[model samples]
Structures are given as structure tokens and as C-alpha cells.
Target: MANDGLSAGAAARRLGVAVTTLRTWHQRYGLGPSRHEPGHHRRYTVDDMVRLQVMQRLTAQGVAPAEAAAWARRSPGTDPAPSDAPPSGPVAPADSPDPALRAAAAAARESILSLVESGAMIADVGLGDARAGGGQTIALGPRVDPAARGLARAAMRLDGPSMRYILESAVTHRGVISAWTNVMMPVLIGIGERYEATDRFIEVEHLLSRAITEALSIVPRPPRELTPRVLLAATDEEQHTLPLEALAAALAENGVPSRLLGARVPSRALMDAVDRTGPAVVVLWSQLPGSGDVTQLQHLLSRPHPPVVVAAAGPGWPLADLPPTVTPLNGLAEAVRVISTVKA
Candidate 1:
């Protein structure tokens, strides 16, 4: 028979905490299962699950345990009626979006991107001198998602906590692709444009990249025994590893483990790694035209036991010059699909 309420293990896994953590929440915080049936152990009801989510979100934001517990306790098994919504107290501003909207944005924002993409503000505002009184701002297209807006604001202030919270929530709920394309990409591209126009805020880019890397690393990988058949690496001396990092995390979420060689792999080192691991597919990434050379792909294809598929990915690659034997992957979704499926 199908399970009715979630088991402690399942709930813990879903929430990305240990069973012990769940137990503590149950025993100490009174956030235990409410669905009781004959004989078997108590199970977590939907209401209990909702409360736990509130607890998890608050704690991750660094709220003191006692205070977070109070908030969780105050959360009704269901959201309050529109008029009955509880007071904001001091945690959030009175005008902040409702928990329901925030939760919805947190859950999935593909539609949000679509909605925002409809506006004229999103009118491909090339990055430039968009500024507030004290700080330089990146121009995200007019039709920006709320989460993206929040992320941009956090990034501008160099607020690591808020950036981490936004990114982690997106990756955890919507998976890597949606998080990357909708939430991360807009901000990233916006920043890149700003850098192009003003050649400033290099620190902001570095910090944001660090936050993204940390958040993506949290996606659990497949079992250790499952050998990684996919390999990802940046070109020699190329420091743009974020896109490749996103691919790795996306693959892991789908249970496809990969070996990432990280930034700046020269031909000799890359070949040594390729010969050693013998990946089924090898994706070489280049973020700048200077780094993306056709010969790098040629070297892979010439290997004695070359991977069945050697794909050139990123905007840097000169797609026209690449040989017919190489597959060209232009985006994260396509890269994940191609790398995960290629035969040895």
C-alpha cells in the first residue's frame, strides 16, 4: 500500500537534514508527526510538514533556535486567512511579499521568468551606469523576477547571508537548471554587462560566484561506487568555472555523477586526466574567445582512447571552426542532456 504520511527518514532526506535532527525537532521543538494510525509509528501530516519548512527556513537564515521555534509555533498548520495573517513583528518589513508568494517563488520560478520576460524594462538593458546614491547597480532587464530582484539587491550590498539563502533556496527547490537559468543567469549576465560597461565591481562578481559555488556543492552526489562517466573542465588558464559547476550540480541532481577538473586545465594535464579516468564524454569549456581554440578539441579527438563524445561548450568556442566530429553544446540544459547520455 502507498504511504499516507511521510516517514521520518523521507522527511529528513527531503529537508536535507539528518534523522537525528528531525528527532530533535520532534522532541525538543514539538514539530513532530501529527498523523496517527493504529499500531504503526506516528507520521508527519501535511500541517506538520509545513511547520517544519518554516522552522528550517528560519534557522537557515540564522535566527536563534528559540526565536525560530517561536515563529514555527506561531505558524498555523495552514497559512492564515488573507485578513488573518499574523503580525510581521520585527523580522520582516510590513510590505514584504506574503509568505505564500515567497514560498511560491522559492518552490519554482519558471513562470516568474516568463512573466518578467514579458515587460519592456527587461528590454535588454545593456549593463552600464545604473546607480543608486552610494552603490553601482547592474541592469537586469525590466521584467525581472522578484527573486532575481532580491538577489540583485543582496548582491549589491555584498550581503553573503542573503545571497546564500536566495541561491540555496532556489537550487534546493527548483533544482539547478531553473536556479541557474532563471535566478542565477539573469544576475550573472547583468553583472557581466556592468563589468563590460564600467569595468568595476570585480569584488561583487567574486563574492557572488563564491556563494553560487557553495550553494551548488550542496546537491548530494550519486553513490561513491558509481564511477563518473562524465568529465567537465575549463580551458587552460581560463578561470570561468561557474557554468561548469552548474552543470556538475545539475547532473548530480539527476543522479548522474561527474568528475570536474576545475578551472584552468592545460592540454597536458587535461589529457593525463582524460587517459586516467576514461570518461564517456568530455566537455571542454571556454568563456572567452581568447581561451577557446579549435586545437584543444582536435587534441581530444586525436587521443588513442578518446571519449565517444568530445563536446565544445560555452560562448567562447568558435563553433564554425570545430570539426564535424565534435558536438557543440551551447547551454546548461543541452550540456547536461548530452553529457549524461553519451556512450563510452
Candidate 2:
């Protein structure tokens, strides 16, 4: 991310690709350098380097050049979505774009940005150097909120206080759903992809998750006098509950009170809790395929008086297997809106 920019050879060297390869990317994909001087070849700016990095990484992961270029072009500061409904996927020179492909690439970029610069940023989570590092920094790319940039830097450094300050400030100012989706989700997903690709930074994930849990928990709950009619639990062995936590916090913010069964609730235990509480709505979360058995949903419906709404929330559940009686929640905002009505 050198501000002065890098020449073709230097940029190619940094990317470990031959200069001809760089030329091919530039000529064919519109990924050419933007920085220029009188009587000199254009140089690669920091933003251009970022796009090239995405191109290099995606191509390395077996993505085709045209497809990768679609992604590289969409990244912040390159040619951003300038409309109310942003376009996604790699844009081809002559053919129509693919939504699914573009979305996946964008999601992957959002998820892996932090880990891409982990080696240097992970140790110095501070506000001052949010933009100081050269190559080893979280890549929120251009057009990201400055808060997210700071948070990503803090997360890479694992500076708990700064992260908490930034996260809490975001949640306080923007609310849980916005903060989670815009701030936390990107870094969380980014670090996760890093782990998937490199099998490292579990510590970063653990610390960040803990910090988020703590911050969200501090959001004041509804008055104790209000009876809890909504129940939330993760399916047995499904340990990913951050989304559930966000849902809980969002609901709490909007004045809906509910019981949260943190994680790993067996079918019997879930059923027992539902049977005992007689909740109006029961939200079961499953974060992985192994624990997302539909039999649990079937078992819940078998109860003499199953909760009025049996909501299956999370990506873990098999979509085809979910019975017609159950509700599927795809995001925190939707979950809160749907559950709030039943409880009200």
C-alpha cells in the first residue's frame, strides 16, 4: 500500500507474477495502474494494489481471470456500485454479469480482508496507525466506513480495548444489526476465511468473539417484570451462536424480551425447555450441517401444543428438510421483526 505507487516491475515482483502476467491482467481486465507522471508509465496506487491482490488471490484459488476481474473491478475505489441496488459479481467485457458469482466473490473479499494483512496488523491494534502500514494491514478497501477501518486495524492487533471501544461505539450509534452486518460481520468472516485458507488466527477469532459477546450483552435487557415468551437455542453440537447473539441483542434493543439458550442444546433439552416455558415462539439455531438435523424440527411439532411459531434460524438447517410449519430466518433484522410480532 505504498502511497507513491509501484512501477510495473515492482508491482509484478511484489505479487510474484511476471511482468507479462501483470500486463495481461491490465490489458484484458482494466486493472492497470492509475497513478501517472509526465513522460512516465502509470504507477500502481494503494487502491490498485488492493484490487490486484484480490485478483491474485482469487486467481490463485482457481478463479478464472475474467471472473476474477469482475470482482477486482467491483472492489472499493475501483468502480463502486453507484446505485441504490448495487451490482455484484465479476463484470465481463462483452457478456452479462452473474449475480451469484459476483456476490460470492464480494463476500469472500469481505471475509478475508483482515487475514490478508494479519502478520503485521495483528500485533498493533491502534487508532493512530489505521492507515500507516504498507502491505500488512486489514483490507476493508476504499469506501468502507472509517469506524470499520479502525476496528479492522484493532482486530488485527487484537487490541481488546480499542476493539471494544470501536464496536461499542458502532453498536451504540448504529444499533446491533447495522454494527453486526457492517462492522463485525466483515472482520469475523474475514478472519474465518483466513483460518480456512491458512488454519491460523483462532486466537484472533476467540478474542474478537468474546469482545463482541461482552459488548452486546451490556445492551440493557427489557424490564424483568415482562415475561419472556420467546426462546432461542442452538441445535445440539452447533456451536456458532454469534448470529443468535446479535438477534438477541437486536430484539432487546427494540423492547422484546426472550430467553437465550447460548449453545449446544440437545433435542431432548430443547424440547424440555420448550415444553416447560410454553413460549409463543421458539427459535432454534444450527450453524453447521452436522448438527442441523430436521428431526429436531419434526420433534418440536409433535408436541401437543408446540410453540405457535417454530422458527428455524441459521444456515445449518437443510432447507429442503424444513417442514412447512416452521419459519426460516435469513438475517438478524428479519428474525427480530418476525419474532417480535409473535411475542407482542
Candidate 3:
């Protein structure tokens, strides 16, 4: 049956809260169900579901339910709005995209490009002169081209010292992982290409890449909790283990016990692991285009007994032909949110 309308049990399940909590909201807050049937069964609609979701999000962010409810009530027909503005304030000013800032960005890009094309190390030129007030020394690196790197660096609102610190930290960290890969990788790649195109920052790209890889390594995975058992692995030809590692870490953080099988596991091995562990969920990492043996995967997914939830992460996921039961994980945050919702 279509679940467009929610019963009390279903609503509680969807909200990730106890049934009693939902009842309390109805009684105390007057956020009652939309309708009551002849037998006194409460029914909630899509609007009610959305309101609950907004309230849940706000409450999770440390807002009191009463405040969230008031905000929701005021907003009415909209999502829950924050009671207060962010301390950092609004994102853009009336005169944003300030002319001076844009010009500086352009000049920085040009400078880096010129130096890189001429075989000069970006770190040698130093970002110190790029500063507005000539207050501090700025150092660019060999891995990125200067001008383009400078523009990107400026955009990030990072100082030379901070950039240097990030680069040094990356050297110790390791490789690209899940949400980081999705959110940061694309931006980083763009920065690198811009530097290359402008001939501004050869060192900047290299330094940034190294730093990101290092940072990934340094971020410790959380200790596994004794919750529902889950197994994680990557498909054959999907040698990137970072996403799986990240998912495992997130799962652990959420108190979902998980074991990582690492990269490039064969189909039989994956099946065997599932058989041996009898896991509730089997997370598979594959950046779509590069994944091999899809047919084998499809066949294995058809098996009965030991119901499994398959989660696919990375670039190739959208392109891959997945079974009806499989879930495409867009990024690290979404993955964690989904897992938590499932657990709840």
C-alpha cells in the first residue's frame, strides 16, 4: 500500500523518535496528527512529515524543540528557520564581489602563471608581497603555480602561513576519502587546472594534492562500536579504498560496528565475507566508470537470506546499474545521515 499517509507507528519510525515522543508532541505542543479515523487512528500527511523532519534537523543542531516549533510555526509552509543568525553573520555584503578583491585575484593568478611557465618555483616568489598591507610574509610552494594558486588561496581566505601549514599537514595525512573527495576534489582539480592554464601555479597544485592526501591519512578512524555488524569493501578495479575507509570511520562514529575489507575485493570474496559475517549492511565502494564485473555483482545481489543493504559511493555510482535494493551514497554526510536514520 502507498504510505503517503503516516500512521503513528510509521510516523515515529520516520522521525527516528520513540512513539511516546510523538504522542507527547501531540499532547504538549498541539502538533497533533492531521486526522483521526473512526477507530481513533491518527493519520499524518506529507506536510506533517516535512514539518517533523525540519524540527528534527533543528533539534539535532542543539535547538530546543519549543524554539524549533515556534520557528516552524512562524515560518509556516517553509522549513524551520534558525532562531538566531550565524555568529559569522550573513555570507555576502551588499557590495560583495568587491572590485579590489576581484582585481587582486586576477593579478595573483597572472603572477603565478608567469613564474611557473618560466620554470621558477612558486614557493620561491613568496606570497608576502601579495598581501594588502605588506604586514606579513607569504610563501607559495613548488607544487602549485603562483598566480592561479594565489587566486585560489585568496578565495579560501587563507594566509600564506596557514596555507603553508595546510600543505605541511597534508604531507603527513594520506589520500582522498569520501565526502572530502566529492566536495573538495572537484574544487581542487579546478584550481589546479586554472593554475596550469594561467601558468601561475605549478607548485600550488602539487602542494594542495599532497596536503589533502596527508590530511586524509591523519584523520583517525573512530573505534568500532558493538552495534549492528556491517562489512565494507570495494569492487574489483575500484582500487580506491579511501571512501570505504571513510564510511567505516563514519559508521564507527555513529556506533554502527563495521569491518573494512579494503580495496579490490573479488565478487566471491565479497560474497564469502557476507556469508561469514552475516552483516546487516554491505557497503561497496566504486567510482562507476572504473568498476569491473558488474554482472557478477548483479548476480550476487540477487541472493536471498541475510537481508543486506548495499551502499555505493564515489563518482561512478550514478552511472552504475544497481539493483533496486542498492542505495547510492552521494557523499560522506549523506551516508552517515542515512545509516543513522536506518539505525534509529
Candidate 4:
């Protein structure tokens, strides 16, 4: 960050985009570096950085690249407004004669502005203020994986594409367990904490949850020839099913197919599912206190044709009250191991 400007690499890093993306914007959209020194590579000045930031934000919100660039080119002056500063007005095309288009533009402007006003678009170039617990970023701690930070920034922006990209990359390269334990879990917990503190960002939570579900579902399932002997379900009235989703994905990663009976499953429904499926292993997940009724576990244990292994997962379950015959799964890896071993 010289007095002159920043290089392409530095600019891209600051914008959380790739150098090639900057190149595309420059060549195709004409949103390139404007500052240059004698015999030196062209550098992006503060103004150019502002334009690129606008472009990044708009495109992340599903606007077309060409349209986003048009808006970016219209960004005023060199400096972006401070995070806490009052918004000047709607940042849309008020001049547009088409009323419908203008209305849509205004809506988009408000969406972005709301995120900024909420401190989710904080001043730090990385989109994270480096400290945890703010509504703006998920605090993954000092030693968090880069992927987690990337995911957190994307989540803050409500940028579905970027979030899915980071998640898929982690699952593809690191495997589901590592992705869940090292990357996804830390950020998920951080977001949960942020929600508890601020009681805001429900949109962030919903979108992140959907993105994670999509990413996990992308893991290839076992071939049709393999019968899935593992059945997974949430406890009665339990709405937190991401942990079970992670478990299901981890099982698939190990070539163990499973039936996932998603959130808020009634007790009778679960038992009926068990009776019909005749699964060799049944895993019930409970994420909150009220949802982890010991009777649910008891019902499974008392079933006439009970599965050989009945496992309890998630923190919702009351460990002290769990039937002695039920196995408790501690983590994603352990759940996978315990269930997979039984299936094998």
C-alpha cells in the first residue's frame, strides 16, 4: 500500500477475489488499475479499489457482471464511506427511466446498504475485523483455517456462490470429516454464538445452512447395488439437523450409505421408519434440551425388532438418562466410525 497504489496481487487479496478475476474485469468490463509509475506495472489506486469493491459486492448479490461494472464505474470519489457513517441515500440508478428496473435497483441497493449498516461490511479489507463476536464476522479464533475465514466472509455477505465454493473445495480436498471438524464446525459454532449475542443475522444462518446442505449432498453416494443399513434421524421436535447432515455426508465419504430422516421427526414416525427400513444401525440426533427427550431413546430400545446398534448424537440428549443399551456418538468422526463399523 504505497502512496501511489497497490499491485494486482495486493488488490485482489484485499478484495477477496483472484487476480484473474481482476484481469477479466479490466479487459472485459474496463474496471482495471488507473495508476502507473514510469517503467512499472499498472497499479490500482484507492479509487480503483473502491470501484472493485462495489463490483465485488454487486456481483456477489447475483447481479450480472456487466451491470455490476456499470454501477462500479459510477462509484463516487476515492474513499468509501466509513462503516458507521450514515448512508447518503439509496445507491441505485435513480436516473433510469424504466420504473420497474429502477425499483429492482433500489431494492438491491437497500439490501447492500442494510448489510453495511448492520456492520457486516466492516472496514477491514478482509471483511473480518480480526476480533470475534461482532455482528459483522464469525470469530474463528487466532488459529482458524483459512477456509473457515473465507467461509465466514462469504456468509457475512450472504454470498451463496462463494460459500458453496469454499465448502465444496474443503469437502473435496480435505474430506467431509476434516471439512466438518476443522473448517465447518468452528465457523458454525461461531455464527451460533454471534446469533445468541446479537439476535440478528438470521438470514446469514439460513443461507449458510442451505449452502452447507447443498455442499454435503454433492458427495457421491454409494452405488445402487449397496443397501444402506444405516438410518439417521433427528429427535422429536429437534430442528437442528446440520449435525446429522454432516454425519450423513461423513458416512457417504466412507462409502457407507445411510437414510437421513431430516429435522423435527416425530417419535412414532421415527419408530415407523425404523420398522419399515429394518436398518442395522439407528442414529438419533438431538440439538436442544427439549428436543432430547429420553423417552425417544427408550422407545427405540423397547422396539420389538430394534436395530442391533442404537446411537445417540448431538448435545440435546440427556446423557445421564440415555438407556444403558444405547451407544452415544461423540463427534462426526466417531459417529461415522461407530455406524460404519456396524454396517460393515
Candidate 5:
């Protein structure tokens, strides 16, 4: 009733929804008002409460949370009418969209999605084919993309040898992770053309992913006395373990001890590992969309125990509607940052 702010818990109570549900709406739909904090607790304004009410109404009517949030933003009487209802300005000549560009973009997106779904590896489409015509040789390496290079520079400061090893492994292995990285090279080149248009980098990419996964599996765990322990693994349906394995290596490099549980770890085994290790974090890697049983996993995660931080990576986590407690691991560098921050 008042415009005064309410904490997330209070607001959730007023809306009669679970706190996880509220946080999900906030993250997915951007429905909540700006958060202001005094000390460390989050507080939401009256506007956010109003939006939540509207969201509830729309959701009850079968509208998705994202669509409901959009509706709430544009509802009548919420804002004044625009000054120009219809512009009478001269219109520029309209040109037809390029079918070739659209096709290329679609093809690239399809390739990436298919690779993730099928667990297809990446292969090097040798630049020799393109270079035979006397064109400049396209360079391929770990820091191949400028953005990835920038990230590498800022994060780990990977040297030429390390970068080369990563790139070579990815190109040769054809693992899904490796393919994603290699494909990123051409995808970056065709950014203006849309993500779907880039050529497939299947074989070498998959090889790289597999190699990374294998390397991480062999990397020794850190000493137990160094810091609080953590367990890293993938969900049962998640065959992609490169991301989690990378995180495990990062933890070892950072002096935080962790056990790499490898890929396709069942929930029972994961819980058993947790019970045995008493870890501070449980990192789960899931790259493929709709591949893991998130609902059941969440129920497992909610149980009382050593307060565990669940870090999720890849495309699957975002679609799983995970609780805010489960943080998204974006990249190798980000994984390091999160673990370091938590340890500190």
C-alpha cells in the first residue's frame, strides 16, 4: 500500500510466491525495481511491488514471466501518452533483407545448437583451403578472437606456449567446448552477419573439448590443508565437463583444493561426495540446454547442510530456472574470480 521499499523476502511473502520464484522473475524478466541497500540487505520499492502484482495476474492468465513483465512495463495509466502518436516524417527507401546473410547466420546458429545437442566435437576446417588462392593466412590459436585475447590478458595472462597448447588441443580434439572456442574465431569475423552464419568448426572443436576434459581429469587436486575444500562435477545428463574441469584446475592453481568429479555425475554420488568432503562449494557444469533434471537437483540443493555455493555454467543453467544461490559461471576467468572472491 505504501511506496516505501520492502525487502525481497517481505515482497515475496506479500506476493504469495516462493523466494526462488521471485528471484527467478527478477533475473529473467527484470520485473523488480532497482535494488538499494543499507548495509548488505536488498530492499525493493513500492513500484516493484506493483509490478509484482501485475506479474502475478498475467502469470495466472498463462502468460510467461518475460511477457508478463513486458506487459507490466506498458500497461495503461502507468505513463503519459507519447507526444507523437504517428510520425508524418519522410520515410527512407526500404531495401530487401539479404537472404544470403540470413542463411549464413541461421546456419552458424544451427551448427552451434546441433553440436551442443549431439555432443559433436569441433574440427579444424584447414585454412589451407582458403589460403591456396594467395589470400592471407587466417591465424588460429587460443587467443584467436580479440575478445578472448583481451579476457586472457586481463585474467590469467596466458603466455604464448600456454595459449598455443590450448588452441592446438582445441583444434585437434574436436570436443564441443573446443569447437565452441574455435567457431568463435569465425563467428567473431562474421559478427555483423549474425551468429548463425559462421562456418561449422566441428571436428577440431570437439577434440579440443575432450582434450581439456581429459587434462583436467589428470590434473592433481590441491592439498587439503591449503583452504576449505570444494567438489566440481557435472549433472547426470550433462556430458560436457570441460567447463567444470577448467574450474577445478583454476581452483588448484589458486591454492583452493577441489576434487574433479568428472562428467555425468549422478545426484546421489554428488551428494555423497559433498557429505564426505564437507566442501564450501559444489560447481556443476551443464552446457547442453534441457539436458539436466534441474527441479530435482534444486530440491537436493535446498536441504540443510554445510552452506554450499552451487556454481553453474553453460547454456543449460540459464534455462533451468535455478535459485539465485546458484551463480552462473560465464567463462574460465569468471570462474577464477568467483572462487577467489568467495575464498577471500
Candidate 6:
């Protein structure tokens, strides 16, 4: 170590986080460097690095940033001249009163490394196969966000609280669209691929889906004054509803109210819903090809008071067979943009 202290770049490099993240920690949470050399920029002393390591570890374990900062600020060993290197790994808050935090701390380092090495920024890192880690890890590809890594690790461990924390943080901080597109989708896809290849991790998939649904449902809905002119449902025999859930949440984020009929809506029932609600927009989701019958879309179009927009979503739909009036929604953002702008 230099006789002075480490610059911000050096500190971020050592900690495996983006320089902007460190700047956020410094500006918002007050976990900034303390050592100011003669005429150079303030640098992170060994003690400052220790606190940040604690901060990094806790946040990676799905702890909220403000709470993690509070813990980091009070972390022991802030006073004395530190050793040449920061602690080799994350330092747990042993004296914490919260048992859940303590439990998470106990396994945070190993769990973080399972999906992301040394808790580094996720880029071009080939996290090994599930079999390599005793079926407790899922690999996300290059340039993925750290929240995705945390969620993947939590999903593998079946840690509901941590998974919820990571997911909620993503949704709250990044908004529903960014959260769904960046953080949640990647992990979900990785797990789906994992299940397909090995015929395993069904439990993992179920739990993660439940967590995502729970997280998305908490997005505050638009006021009742604005009637929900948008309707969402899955086609007959289509049990997959997570994407629809995400769309609902994203719409809510845009202050657009929507009625979500959930999974496996029969053609008759969906028609009945459309008739009763007279929704301006109706989105039918189909996750598998067999479930996406073009006839269903035809049924909606034939209604006496047909919707302004009848949309088909998910990979199951046969684009060529879709009714001429039906709008094909390729992704969540596009679905939101199309549905939220419809005239009643």
C-alpha cells in the first residue's frame, strides 16, 4: 500500500464495483474517503476500504443500501492504522441484533462467489454450471447487473427474504421496466434454460416466480377514479403468467390501471371478461405454442363491442396465424407502451 491512500479508481477496482456506485455510496450514504493527501484528491484509507468492504458485502447479500450504510459506518476497526490489505473477504456484522442479517452475513461471501467471483461486476465471467456447484448456482452472461447476480444466488439457495430484497430493490430503484428487462428477465431466462437442460430446479423456478409476482404486486396501482380500461389474461391452458404480471406492474408504474385475470383463462371466460369490462385494450398471453390458438383472438374480434386493441403476447403465438386486428407485443416495454396509450 502507498504511504498515502488509494484513489477512487484504485479503490473501485479493488472492490469490484463501478466508480459510479462508489460515488453514490459517498454522496448519499456518507461512506466516502477520509485521507486527503497534500495536493491530490481525497483517497480511501485502509480503514475506509474495510468499511466499504462491509458495505459491499451486505448490499450484495440483498441488504438495503441505507441500512447497510448504517452498519458500515459503525463497523469496528475504523480507528486504528489498518494492515497493508483490506480484509481478504466480506466482514459480517457479528454484533448485529437482527438474526436474519446475521444469518445472511454468515453465508454471504460464499453465496456471492458461487454466482459471481469475488463479488465483481458481472461481465464476461463464465460462472460454472449448476452441477459444478452442487446445483446451487445459475450463470448470467456478460454485462449483467449486480442485482441480477444477487437474485440468482438467492434463487439457488432458495433464500426467500434475500430474493425478495434483491427483487424489490431492483424494482424500486430501477423502475418496473428496467427491473423486468435487466435484473429479473436475465435470471429468469437463465433458470428456465437450466431447467430445460437438466429437468431440475423446478423448485427454484417456482420460488423465484412467486417472489417476482409478490414484488411486482406491491407497485402501487392507479387510483380507482381512473377505471381500468386495460385487461390482461393468459390464453386457455397457458399457465405462465409472470410476464403478464410484469406488464401489469409496468403499467401501474406508468399510472395506468389494469385488470389482470391471471393464468389459464378459458376462451369463454375471457370473452365474458371482455364483455363485462368493455376494456379498451385486451392482452392475451400464451407461453407455449399449443396454448396460443389463433381462434381465441378471432373470438375477441367477433365480439359485438370489440376492444380498441386486442394484443397477443409471449413466444407461444403464431405470428402468421394472428388475426389482422390483433397487435403483437414483442416485449414488456412495448406492451406497456401500446396498452397504456389506448383510448377508451
Error of 1 at 106 (Å): 16
- Worst window of 10 by summed lDDT in candidate 1: 124-133
Candidate 6: the clashing residue pairs are none
Clashes of 5: 33
Candidate 3 TM-score over all chains jointly: 0.42
* lDDT per residue (tens digit) for residues 1-344 in model 4: 34556777666655556677787788766677887779998877656766776676556434557776666665544333222222232344526564433333344445444545675444324432222222377777988786787688788867686688678867887899999988788878988998899898888889999999999989999997988899999988888889988988888889898999998889999989988989999899988888889888888888998899999998988899888999989998888877877833
Provide the lowest-lDDT 10-residue window in model 4.
Answer: 81-90
For each candidate in turn, give its C-alpha RMSD to the true structure in angstroms. 16.9, 12.7, 25.2, 13.8, 25.3, 12.5
Per residue, candidate 1 scores C-alpha lDDT tens digits across 232-315 of 999986889999999999999988989999999999899999999998899999999899987878999999999999988898
lDDT per residue for candidate 5 within 1-344, as digits (tens), equals: 22335666656654445567666666665555455557755555444555565555444323445555555444432321122122122221222263322232233334334543563322211112211212212233544544233223211211222333333333334433343444333423332232234443333344434434454454455666675567788888887665666666656666677778887888888877777777777777777676656753574576677435677766676554777667777876677777766742
Error of 5 at 140 (Å): 8.0
* lDDT of candidate 6 over 1-344, digit per residue (tens): 45466777767765556567777788777778888767788877656766676676667655667777666765654542233333222333548687545444434433433423443423322223212233356879877877887788768766676688778767886899999998899999999999998999999999999999999988999998999999999999999999999999999999999999998999999999999999999999999999999999999999999999999999999999987789999999899888877878
Candidate 3 lDDT (Cα, 0 to 1)? 0.51
Off by over 4 Å in 5: 1-202, 210-221, 224-228
- Pairs in steric clash, model 2: 70-90, 70-91, 89-102, 111-190, 122-156, 122-157
Residue 207 of candidate 2: its Cα lDDT?
A: 88
Count of clashing residue pairs in every prediction: 4, 6, 36, 0, 33, 0
Off by over 4 Å in 2: 1-136, 139-143
lDDT of candidates 1 onward, in order: 0.72, 0.73, 0.51, 0.75, 0.50, 0.77
- Candidate 3 lDDT over 95-131, as tens digits, reads 3354432332233334334444564431212222222
lDDT of 5 at 75: 41
User: Across residues 247-340, which tens digit of lDDT does each residue of candidate 2 receive?
Assistant: 8899999999889998998999988898898999989998888888898899999999988999998888999889999999988889988988
Backbone clash total for model 2 is: 6
